[model samples]
Target: MKRIAALFPGQASQYKGMGRDFYLQYQSVRDIFNRASEVIDKDVYSICQDEKMLQRTEYAQIGIMVLCIAIFDVVKREIESPIQFFAGHSIGEYAALTCSECLNFEDAVKLVQIRGTVMGKFGGEGKFAMANMGSASNDVIMEECIRFSDDIDFVSLSCDNSKEQKIVAGSSKAVKRLVEGTEDLFHGKVINNLGAFHTNYMLEAQKEFNETLCHAKFHEMKKVVFSNVTGRPYFDETQVYPLLGRQMVKTVKWRQTMDYLKKMNIDEYWEVGPGCVLTNILKREDPSINVKSADKILKMEGTGNEKIC
Candidate 1:
């Protein structure tokens, strides 16, 4: 039997037309979107269909998670293989939890709405994220963090795309300084994110989230799901609430998470979100393992190659 893996995308993978196909093709998917709209009090369907909605972080957050979950639901109903393990990047962890049945759909949507509100309140404009820096040791990254700590306040290591590649985050000014300072160290690229995340700057938001999660209820997971904060399996439903609260303030260990999946003997990695960001990372880390993205899978029309719709 194939050891299938499910991947979820984080904030950046969202787009205007992401879930429209699913909404048009399946009633179940349409119902999920409708439910999200009611719980979040936002028109998620319009948000997913409109380019203007992409500008708002709160709407984008809910949009990405809903799309990710909706896509996973579709794939689960269609695929016959038994899923071995589940994981998600950053915010995608919540999506994995919903998939694993650790959190109910309505609660997850409400939590994410609250999460987006708190995150926005604490992390204002001028905060940013950067991507595509060559992999340096934690010490090396820390040293750079220290040099710019006056301004940058290093937040988190977003993703470990490969042994030689990783993404860094900080405030916009500080990130700019780091990029200017390390131009010689990194020859690749440093693309910025929508805002500052996975850093101490978001502590206030985390505090609010801690209170919110403390009172929330979680169900025992039906399948093993990994945490972005710990890069380990979620053993108890109680621990999930706190882990999420601390996740914003902690660096994401994407490399370690993938390592754990490799240890679990994951035969194939399937990215069940709108984009293939995680799939790209898996390929760079180990190209031999099968990596498939839901977008590619759904777009294929009885052919192995991706098709345009």
Candidate 2:
């Protein structure tokens, strides 16, 4: 049997009609969507179809997580390959956990709704910010991030997507400084963030998330799941909640995650989510690596890999 790594994409991978085809074709998917709507009372079915709502961090996070799981639910039954590993990018981790059986689908939806609202309240509302910086060595990027985070406002080195991709989030002032400080040496894009994700700026949300998590039941992982905090499979079932709780303020070690997967001799990388971002990112890192989105395994045409047109 081929060793498989199942990955999930994060926010910004959402589209207006991402899960519509799946919902239409699969009764199971429709049930998942409807249940998600009832769990959060946000009409997730309508949220995915509305452009304005999809753009909001709070709504987008919930919709994205639900879409990932709904798609995974179908893909799981279709695929013959046994998955050896699983990882999600940021908010995608919730879906990863849900699929891993660490958290139930209803609890996952409820958690993401709270996550979105809090993140949107802080980062999306303009209190906090995020930016993608690149075209420089990792050392240079870390130096600048550390300086701003320590001396200036709270800036965090958020997502390490790859050797060339680095994300930072913090106070708006600090992120602005990050952009200005690196403008001469590198290129960057300021992202519309719902919160200072994976940064200390999310402490308030982390607290609430922790409190909420206390009420949610987390089971042992049914399959190996990588954690953003460590860029490694969770140490044990007991660490699941704590790691997830602290995940909000920790850097997502995606670069390390890919490195770890390679070391594990993963033969195929499967991205079971709305966008191909996770699979594509891995491909860019190593062109020879085998990568596939859920569409191929599910034998479906619309995986929402393209922009909604």
Candidate 3:
């Protein structure tokens, strides 16, 4: 028996027509889009199909969530293997929670809608931006960030995607200054966005999101779920809400989460959302690990046994 871990993709993974194939083939997937539309009061299917509408942060977040869950639903119907662990990146975490039965689909949809609205509103108030630092060690990035913090308004390490790929977020001026000063050390590129997420810059958004989470109900996890903030499996239901609140203003410990999963001796890994972002990260981390995308798995001749890793 193989122990399977499912990874969900977050923001930056959305693309036009992400779930169109799944939506057309499965009524269950179409029903998910319908429910999402009713809850968010937006035609999610149309938004996902249109490249322009999918670019807006608020719309993109909800659209990604709907598509992720829909893809997971279709995969679940086809595969009977029991998932040993569920984890997602950023917004994808809600989909993991839904998979673990920690949150209902309707509630998850509404919460993400509120989360997207709050983040979009508060995120654009400043000249915030995010940048990816390639071919750099975590310690080096952290050291540079700290060194520049004395002069920069807000400079902090955001996502530790892998050993060689890290992200930084802060005010645009601060990020630009840091990048210019350290240009010789590593390859860097600024991501297009208004808000610096997973840093103190999102304090206001975190507070507002906490209020919304207070009303949201969470159930006991049916399967082990890892936290992007803590990079560990949640011990109990009590840790869910607070960790999620803090996740908005904390660095995503993705590399650490991957390390933890490897330590657990997980036999197989599955990327259950749009794009191959998480899957590619996992492959780079360890080529020997067995991994596959659910979308490709669905297209195979029979219950797909081929592994991409």
- Among these predictions, the greatest TM-score belongs to 3
lDDT head-to-head 1 vs 2, winner? 2
Error of 1 at 208 (Å): 1.4
Residue-level lDDT tens digits of model 1 in 1-309:
888889888877877788776778778888889999988777888888777676566777888888888878778877779775888888898898898888999989988888877876777845666655686777776677668757435544555545777777777666776777888986536675566778778788889888888877889777888888888888878778778878888877777888888888877777987777788878877778788788633456576653211
TM-score of each: 0.91, 0.90, 0.92
Q: Which lDDT tens digits does candidate 3 get at residues 1-309?
A: 678888999888888878777777779989999998998788989988888877667788888888888888766655568887988999999999988889999999999998888888777735788888886887788888877775447678899988877999988877887888899987688876657888887899889888989888889877999999998999978889989989989999988999999989998888987789988898987788898886433445585543222
Per-residue lDDT value at 195 in model 1: 69
**Residue by residue across 237-292, what tens digits does model 2's lDDT show?**
78888788888888999998889889999887878777688877877878889887
lDDT of each: 0.77, 0.80, 0.83
Task: Give the candidate number with the greatest lDDT.
Answer: 3
- In angstroms, the error of model 2 at 233 is 0.3
RMSD of each: 2.7, 3.7, 2.8
Clashing pairs in 3: none
